[model samples]
Target chain A: AQSVTQLDSQVPVFEEAPVELRCNYSSSVSVYLFWYVQYPNQGLQLLLKYLSGSTLVESINGFEAEFNKSQTSFHLRKPSVHISDTAEYFCAVTISGGYNKLIFGAGTRLAVHP
Target chain B: GAGVSQSPSNKVTEKGKDVELRCDPISGHTALYWYRQSLGQGLEFLIYFQGNSAPDKSGLPSDRFSAERTGGSVSTLTIQRTQQEDSAVYLCASSLLAANPLTNEQFFGPGTRLTVL
Candidate 1:
């Protein structure tokens, strides 16, 4: 079983400012981690994923997340955010095996203000 | 050049009525999933389908929720005796394979918004 917790419900940041969205997970077995972004009136779009081999993962949109095993965290970060980045972000986890199920966090609303 | 697609983009129905939402996954994808998103909330897992075998239905909230996939392609999610609480955006997703436990990336549909009045 896997559970994801997103530490913040809302984050307000000025355009071009650095930001981080914290996510933690509890799982007895190995898990895969993912970040998804949802724009207004749209469904979720995959941002990045941490599968294996590398502790750090990045998306083409200038966002990245590092998977820390000891810390049990997969926090998303961006060196500079844009107004277009204002959206709801969710962190999800899924255990390895048959009948894999995804557990998602409540989500963090990123408000990028110019 | 197609992605996951869902139908009845918006629906409004009276209480106690039943509704059916549809999903058409990407070509050749074998794994499909159903999820619900309420106002100001994240994705809620509902069900999972893999090939023609039995589905994983552990996440369904109640007996009123049921889903079926036909010919290993399209799917339909049915909600019975709809209640106000059932009003939400129903999302459908599919993966090339059952999310490789190591790295699962599920492609999502635009979603169907249901409103029970």
Candidate 2:
């Protein structure tokens, strides 16, 4: 079984500021990591994912996340955030073998202030 | 036709009533999934269906929650005798064949917000 933990429940940042959302997971075997974002009253959208190869993966919208095996962490980062970036973010993990199911974190609410 | 579509964007039901939520996955997506999101909480897996494989219902909170996918396309999640705790947004998602080694991106639906009173 795999589980994901997001340390921050709420993250507030000013426009154009850098922000990082921390996520950690525990699993016996290798797992896949993913980040999804949800805007107000909207469904979640895939931001980025770390399946294999490079430990660092990036999204087209200036969001990136690094997968750390040693630390068991996959933290999401953005160099500069815009007011429109305000939304709820989730970190999820799925085991490679066995049943394919995603274990999600509690989620982090990012409020970008203008 | 563009993305995963869900019916009844919002459902309001009374306690002890039964409610059903529907989902239409994207064409060609063989893997369908159901999840629930409580207020201020993360998504809880309910069931997963992949190409004639046995559906995985491990994450279902209780027997009150049940789901079924038909013809490898649409899926329905039902909550019998719904309780206050069942008041949450029911979401459905789908992806290509899980066995395929390519990037697995599960496209999500708008989700049905069920409010129990």
Candidate 3:
């Protein structure tokens, strides 16, 4: 079985400050990693994904994550965050060749203050 | 194009009662999925349906939980004899199920929040 673990339940940072949300996974087989963001009262939207090729994947919103196979981790990072960046982030994983059912971690709430 | 949509954004039902949550996936999407979000469980996959193939019920918590996708577009998650533990947000997502799994992005609905009294 595959599982995801978000080290932090909540992260508080000031606007314009850098932030990193830690995520680690345990899987017996190769897996694909993803980050999904959920704004308050909104549905979750895909942030970015690491499927193949480069180990580092980035989203349009200046957020990036690197897949570290040795560490079994995919941590999301933002150089500088905005007030609007406050949302819940989830780390998900699925077997590379298996069906599309996603195994998600307990989300991390990002609270960006002014 | 419109995204995934779910009905009865908020539902309040008594314990031991039954409830049905509906999901309308994006048109032409061949794959649909049901997930539950709660304080205890976070987000968990409950069921999955792909095209005309047999649905996957491996993620269901118990026999009281069931789901069906008709015509490969609309899906309904039925919870019979609901309990307080069943009070959670039911989320539905759909994907195109492309030949490349990397391209198959799942779009989520606003979700139906169910409260059991």
Candidate 4:
């Protein structure tokens, strides 16, 4: 079985400040990792993913996450955040195969204050 | 082009009542997924459908939950004997039919918020 953990339930930060959302996973087999964001009253939107290749992955919206194998972590980070960046972030995983369902973390709520 | 759409954006039901949610996936997409998000919680996978094939109902919480996809287009989720614990937003997502499936991105719908009193 595979599971994901997002330790921080809520994070508060000032605008233009850097922030990191921590994620850890426990899996018996290799899995694919993903981060998704959900704005207020909105559906989930994929932020970034680590399928394979480089440990570091980036999204177009200035969010990045690095896959750390030894630590079993995939943490999301942004050097600077805007108020608009405040949202609910989720970390998910799926078995390394075709069209499988994703197991998700409890989610982290990022609140950016102006 | 239209994205995924769901019906009855909000549903209110009594404890013993039943509720049915619908999802219309993106055109020509061959993969569909169902998930549940409880209040202030993350998503829980419920089921998945690929084409007309049988759906993967492994994540369903109980026998009270069932889903069906027809004509490889639309899908419906039915909850029998709903309880307060069943109250949550039901999400539907769809992806393209690819050989590897990893290359496809799953697009989501607004979700149906089911509230059981």
Candidate 5:
């Protein structure tokens, strides 16, 4: 079984400031990690995912997450955040032969203030 | 082309009433999924369908919850004698294939917010 844990419930940062939303997961075998963002009253959109190869993955919106196998973590980060970056972020995991089931964490609400 | 779409964006009903939520997967996508999001359970996978068949229903909370896909495109999730605990945003998503789990990106729907009173 695979599971995710988001360390923060809410993260508030000033505009143009760097922020990190922490996520940790546990699984017996190799797993895929994904980060998804949901804006107010909208569905979740994929920010990025880590399957293989490079441990670092980036999104077009300047958000990046690094998969640290040793730590069993995939924490999302942004060097600089815009007010529009405020949204709910979710970390999800799916292990091999799990029938495409993704177990997600409780999510962290990111709020960027000006 | 349209992304995944769900019907009844918002629903309100008294406890013990039955409800059905609908979903239409993206064109040419062969895999579809259902999820529930709430303050308590967070986001949990309810089920997934490959084509018109559902091979995994392990995520369904109880026997009261069931889903069916028809014509290999649309699906409807039915909750019998809906309880207050069932009140949550029901989400739908679709992917290209069930195999090669890593490459399949599930496109999500806006979700139907069910409110039980």
Candidate 6:
């Protein structure tokens, strides 16, 4: 079975500060990694995904994540965050060619302070 | 285009009662999925439906929880004899295809928050 672990339950950062949300997964076979962001009282939206090719995937919102095959990690990073960036971020994984059911982590609450 | 939508944004039911949560996936989406988000379980997949194929019920927690997708567009997740443990937000997502990751990006609904009293 595949599983995902989000190392931080909560991440606090000041506005314009860098932030990194750690995520690790345990899967025997190849997998697809994704980051979903949920703003206050809103549904989750796809932030970015690492399917193939580039190990470093980026979202249009200036957030990026590097898929480290050796470490089995896909950590999300942002050079500088804004107050609007405060949200709950989730890390998810699914088998490369298997069913589309996603295995999600516990989620990390990103509290960007002004 | 409109995204996935879920009905009864919030549901309050008593224990031992039954409840039904509805999900309306994006039109033309071939794949739909149900997931539960709770304090204890976080987020867990409950069921999956793809086109006309057999629905996957492997992720269901127990027999009390059942779901069905009709016409490949709308889905209903029925929880019979609900318990306090069943109190959580039920989320629904849909994608164009279930096979290819390049094009299969799941779009989620606002979710139905269920509270068992």
| Interface quality of candidate 4 as DockQ | 0.60
For candidate 5, give the DockQ.
Answer: 0.75
**What is the TM-score of chain A, computed separately for every candidate?**
0.97, 0.97, 0.99, 0.98, 0.97, 0.98
> Candidate 5 at A33: error in angstroms?
0.3
Candidate 5 wrongly placed segments (more than 4 Å): none
Clashes of 2: 0
Question: Where is the poorest 10-residue window by lDDT in model 5 chain A?
Answer: A94-103
* Residues A12-88, model 4: lDDT tens digits: 99999999999999998888899999999999998999989999999999999999999999999999999999999
Clashing pairs in 2: none
Winning model by DockQ: 6
Kindly report which residue pairs in candidate 1 clash with one another. none
Q: Distance (Å) between predicted and true CA of B93, model 4?
A: 0.6
lDDT assessment of candidate 1: 0.90
Docking class of 5: medium
Ranking by DockQ: 6, 5, 3, 2, 1, 4
Q: For all the candidates, what are their Cα RMSDs to the real structure?
A: 1.4, 1.3, 1.0, 1.4, 0.9, 0.8
Question: How does each model score on TM-score?
Answer: 0.96, 0.96, 0.98, 0.96, 0.98, 0.98
lDDT per residue as tens, model 5, B1-117: 989999999999999999999999999899999999988999999999999999989899999999999999999999999999999999999999877866589899999999999
Q: Which stretches of candidate 4 lie over 4 Å from their true place?
A: B98-101
Task: List TM-scores of chain B, every candidate.
Answer: 0.93, 0.92, 0.95, 0.93, 0.97, 0.96
Q: What would the per-residue lDDT of candidate 1 be over residues A14-61, giving only the tens digit for each residue?
A: 999999999999999988889999998888999999888889999999
lDDT (Cα, tens digit) per residue for candidate 6, span A5-64: 999999999999999999999999999999999999999999999999989999999999
Off by over 4 Å in 1: B99-103
**TM-score of structure candidate 6:** 0.98
Q: Enumerate clash totals for all models, in the order shown.
A: 0, 0, 0, 0, 0, 0
Interface RMSD of 6: 0.7
Give the least accurate 10-residue stretch of model 3 chain A, judged by summed lDDT: A93-102
| Correct interface contacts retained, every candidate | 0.65, 0.60, 0.65, 0.56, 0.70, 0.84
Model 2 agreement with the true structure over B83-103: per-residue lDDT tens digits: 988888889989887654364
Position A8, candidate 4: lDDT: 99
